[model samples]
Target: MTVVRAKLGAHLHSMTAPFLFVGSGLSRRYIGTEDWEGLLRKFAALTPRPYEFYRTSAEGDLPAVASKIAEAFYDIWWDSDDFSSSRKKWAGSMEGRESALKVEIAKYLSVPPALTGLANRESLEIEILKKAVIDGVITTNYDSLLA
Candidate 1:
């Protein structure tokens, strides 16, 4: 372990511009964002169907479940004729529900101000990485933490 650490330190010192590939687990660990199942469950609660229907029907496919939820939300939003004039105009001008769904999910996953504590080892590591002269960061997470 000591040898590996020394080698990694040497490599980091020698490397010119390193790139990062971040995953959802990093945000989940540091910022307390929900996992796929948890996120789906939240959205499922908004629908008339039980959460388990979406959770189990997806068979571990989160993207499918997300699509289903977005469709349902779109239908609900479209069918509602009770919106105020301003809201009606806004809703009519909108393009698609998928974009709105993404916005909602991003809001949900955002790290709250109180959860920004960086005293832990994981956060410390992220801080170090932020200070490094990296070339770029590639992440699969939908949140804008890297930005």
Candidate 2:
């Protein structure tokens, strides 16, 4: 770990310019104003174990939970419309929301293990190297307040 950090530190230090490719991990937090988090929190409140599920990765398939979350989003959008819409519209909206929501949920479950491995790398960059993100950080996380 230390060796890898040293090598990366050396590489970064040698570079004429400084930049960091900070990704969604730095932005996404379980706490936020997003309807997704609210749904998850509500699910936790109703379930036998909320925090446990939040901390642990979903067992087996996650599609069921993902669907539930998707349904919640669709319901909200539908409620906002003053006039009744066809099922196709709701389905389309649900499909789009479902795709993005599922990706995020899967990312949430998978990111921790991946990040754990990179923890040393980040630590070395932040603490030992004291590198700066010279070009500024860019991310596409909707939950993030970068905009």
Candidate 3:
């Protein structure tokens, strides 16, 4: 373990441009973001059906679950005559909930408190990541912290 760590450290130091590919776990740990199921459950609560129905129906297929939830959301949005002008306009322009899901995920993952004073709260791992001479940080994460 010590040897591997030393070798990895050497390699990281020598690399000119290393890209970090982060996932939702990083956000969950540092920013307290929900996992995919948790996010789905939250959105499902807004639908007419109970959250468990959506949860069980998805059977671990998040994209499909999101599509189902999106349909429900569209229905709600369509039936509501009380929406603000801006909201109504936005809903009218939306093609589907996929984009809206991305927006919602981004909002949930982006915790302002976690990012504030980041430089002052750097951990050893964070410091090492900072030391890497990277051309860019690539992530599938929806949050703007890495941006």
Clashing pairs in 1: none
In TM-score terms, candidate 1 sits at 0.66
Worst 10 residues of 3 by lDDT: 80-89
lDDT at residue 131 of model 2 (Cα atoms): 46
Global CA lDDT computed for model 2: 0.46
Tens digits of per-residue lDDT for model 1, 21-82: 88877777766666676777777776788777865777757788887777776665455453
Residue 133 displacement (Å), model 2: 4.5
- Model 3, 75: alpha-carbon shift in Å? 2.1
Writing each residue's lDDT as its tens digit, candidate 2 over 74-141 gives 44434544214433333454456455444334434433332233455664643443445465555445
Once superposed on the true structure, which residue ranges of model 3 sit more than 4 Å away at CA? Answer: 1-15, 79-89, 97-113, 116-128
- Superposed Cα deviation of residue 113, candidate 3 (Å): 5.1
* Candidate 1, lDDT over the whole model: 0.68
Maximum-lDDT candidate? 1
Clashes (backbone N, CA, C under 3 Å), per candidate, total: 0, 0, 0
Compare candidates 1 and 3 on lDDT and give the better one. Answer: 1
| TM-score, every prediction | 0.66, 0.33, 0.65
Give the lDDT of residue 86 in candidate 2: 38
Sort the predicted structures by lDDT, highest score first: 1, 3, 2
Better of 2 and 3 by TM-score: 3
Q: List the residue pairs that clash in candidate 3.
A: none
